[model samples]
Target: MTPEGTGRALVVGGGYAGLVTARVLADRFDEVTVLEQDHVTAAPEHRRGTPQSRHPHALLARGADLLEGLFPGLRAELREAGAPVSDFGQFPMLYPAGWSPRVRTGLALQTFSRPLLEAAIRRRVLAHPRVRLLDRTRAERVVLNDARDRVIGVRTTGDALRPADLVVVTTGRNSRLPAGLSTAGLPAPDVLRVDGKLSYTSRVYRRDTASPPDWQASLQATLAPTARRGGTVVALEDDRWLVCLFGADGQSAPTDPAGFAAYADSLANPHIKDVVTRAEPLGSIYRYGGLGGQWRRYDRIRPWPGGLAVLGDALCVLNPLYGHGMTVAVQQAVLLARELDAHGPADACARFQRRSARTLLLPWYLSTSLDLGWRPEGASVQALLARRYLARLLRRIPDDPELYRRFLAVQHMTASPLTLLVPSARGPSARARRGGERS
Candidate 1:
C-alpha cells in the first residue's frame, strides 16, 4: 500500500538506530514502519537479534541528552522502572589515567542492560502516532528498481513486495547488506577490522548489597598500552545487577563462570572479581565473540539507491569497548532528520549517506586508533603515535585537573575532538595548541 503524501518509509532492523531513524522519517514522510526479524518484547529479556544485549550497557551523558530530546521523559521513565541514575562523579571510574578521583562532577552515565534499554526505547517509539512497528519480520532482500541505483522496497518472506519511498537498514553487525545488494552490480565496501581476535563473555548477578555495582569504574584500562580489558555493573530493576567483563583481542573472557572470574581477577585491578565473588549469581555466563569494528560505505558509490539508506550497524559498527555504538546510532538519526529537513526525497538518500559517514568518521577513526594500540601484533605507525600520546596524557591527567577534566569532557562527547589540541583553555589563544590540548 502506498503511504499518502511522500509514501511510506521503512526502517529495517529494530535496534536503537532503526527505531530512532524511523521516527525521524515519520516526521518527513506520511508514515513510517520498523521491521525486525526477532520477536520484540515489552519486558526486558535477552533475545536473538542482539546477542550482545546480555552485557551491561550505559547511556553516556551525550547520548542520554540526544535520546531525551528525541523522546521526552525517557530518562524519568527509565528511572521509574528501576534503572539507577549515576552521576559519574560518584561512580568509580578508573580511566587509563588512574582513578578519576570519584569526584561529584562529570557527565551522567545511566546504567542498565542492553535489552532493558532497547525495550524501553522500543516502547517509546511504538507510542509515536505515525510509526508502525512490525516484529519477527525479516527483511529478505532489497527490492531494486529498473535503474538499480536505488532500492524501491524490501522483499519479505511472505513473497510480497513491501515498497516504500525510503528504506533504512539497521540490521546490525551481522548484516549481509553488502552481498545482498551486490547483485545490483555495485561492489561491496572493503572490510577494515582491528579484530585482535577479541571475544566477549558476560553474565548478570543478584547482589545482596544495597550499593550499586562499582567494579566497572575502578579498572585502569586503555587500548594502547597493554592488552586492554574492562568490566561494568548496571543496577537493574528489583534490586538486581548486570555485570559485564571484556578482554581485548587474544585475551578472551572465558565462557565458564569460574574461568570468567579468574580472567577478571587478572585484570589490572581485582575489584571486578571481588564484586562478582560477593554478588549472588543470577544466570549462567553468556559468551559472544567475533566483535570487531566495521564500516559499510553504502553511500560511497557513484550512485546509491535513491529511496534507500542504511543506519546503525548496517552502516558503521564501532568497537563496543568505546561504548559509542548506541550513541552513534542516535546521532545518525538526528542527522537524518536534519538532512531531510533541508532537501527533497529525490536527493536525500545520497545526502543522508554522506552525512551519515561524516557523523561516523571521527568516532570510527578514534575507536580504531585505540584498537590498534591494544593489538601489538598489528601495530601501525600512526596507531603507535596515538597510543603514545594517549599514554602520556593519562600519566599526566591525575596531576593536571584541568587537563583531566577536559579530556573527560571530550571522551564523554561533551566537547569536540579539537579540545585536546587547543592552547587557550577556552579557545585559540596567544599560545599555539599542542596535541589538541591547551598549551
Candidate 2:
C-alpha cells in the first residue's frame, strides 16, 4: 500500500466528482482506477445508472470555469455539438420577479442535460493514459491495514479485496457509507438530514414555437400555498428542449399534458405556461418525489480512517432545485486534488475530509435555508419572516435589474451570497449604513 512511488488509487464512482478526481489523480499518481456499477457509454439517453439524468441541469459559471481549466476546449466542443452557450438573457427566463426583462447582465450559463455533461467528462477521463474505467464493479468493503483502522483497498460486493494506496467513495445521494462501515463493524460517522416536503413531475418538450418573451434561460415560478415550481428549456446537442417542472407535494406537477399545462397556468408567471402550450412533445413525463436535504459529517470524527475518503453526493447533497449539487461536487473535487497533491507523501485522508467539510458550508446553508420556506403542516415564525423578506426582494427584482443580476450571480454559484449585502450596486442603501444597523 505504499504511495511514495506511484501507487494505485481507486475512486469508487464515476459521477462528476469521481471523474474529476480520477483525472487529477492520473496526473500525479502512477495509476487511477474508477469503478462504476454501470457501463459507461457515449449515448445521450438516460439509463438506470442515473435516474435524474433525464432532468434539466446546468453547469454554473464557477463549475464551468473549473471544467474548462481541467479539460480545455470542452466548452467549444459542447457549443459545436449543439449545447447552448450564452448569457442569462439569451434564453427565456422567469422568476417571482416577473418575466425577467431581456437585458444583458453579463452572467453566463451552460445549458445541457446531465447525461450530456457526463458524456463530455467521461470522454476526458478515459483519454488519460493512467486512468482506467471499470464497469459493473460493486464496492463491498475497505481493505484495512494491520492497525484495523487504515484502509488500503476496496473489496467489491462480490469481488475480492484488492490493495490500493487510496480509496474514495463517491457513491452519490443514495450513499451507503455509514451502513457499509457499520456492516464492516466500524464506528458510524456523524450524519445530518434536512427535508423540505417538496415534490414535482417533469416532461420534456421540443419547443416548436419561438420561446416566450423575457423568458428566463430558466424559470423558478412562485406558486400557490406558498409553494414553488421551476423548469429549464436547455438546448441539448440534438436540438431538443429538456423541460422540467417541480413543486411542493400538495401542488406537485403532473405528467399528463392537460394536467401539466393546468399547473403551468397556475404559476405566478405566465411565460412558462405560454411555452408549454406550444412546445412539441418529446417524451413522456418522468416523475420523482422525496425531495429533501442531507449531509455526512466525516470530518467531525475524532480519529478519521487512513487510506479512505469520500466525495460527490456521498459527502453532501443539496436540493436539486438549487442546481448546486454538481457545482459544489466539482468544487469539492478540485479541493480534493489540491489537498492530495500537498499531502501526497503523508497521511491525507483525514485532512481531505476536513477541507471537504469546510467547503460544503456555503452550499449546505443555501439549500437548507431555501427548503425551510415551505412545510408539510406549517412553517415557523422564522420561516415566515424569512419567506416574507425574500419574497419582497424577489418581488422588487423586476424594477431593479441590478438586483436581478446579483440574484442570478449568487444563484449560479459565481458569487457568494454575502456579496449582495455588502456595499455595492443594489446593496444596502446609505441610509441603512448610516443607521449602523441591519437592513
Task: Compose the digit string of candidate 2's lDDT tens values, residues 72-191.
Answer: 998998887777667875554455435554457676766777777778888888888889988888777676766667887888867688678888889888877788677766778777
RMSD of each: 5.7, 5.8
- Against the true structure, what is each candidate's TM-score? 0.89, 0.87
Candidate 1 matches the true fold with a TM-score of 0.89
Give the total clashing residue pairs for model 1.
Answer: 8
Clashing pairs in 2: 92-215, 92-216, 92-217, 93-215, 93-216, 94-216
Task: lDDT for model 2, please.
Answer: 0.70
Q: In model 2, which runs have C-alpha deviations exceeding 4 angstroms?
A: 1-5, 89-93, 209-216, 222-225, 376-392, 423-439
In angstroms, how far off is 204's CA in candidate 1? 1.1
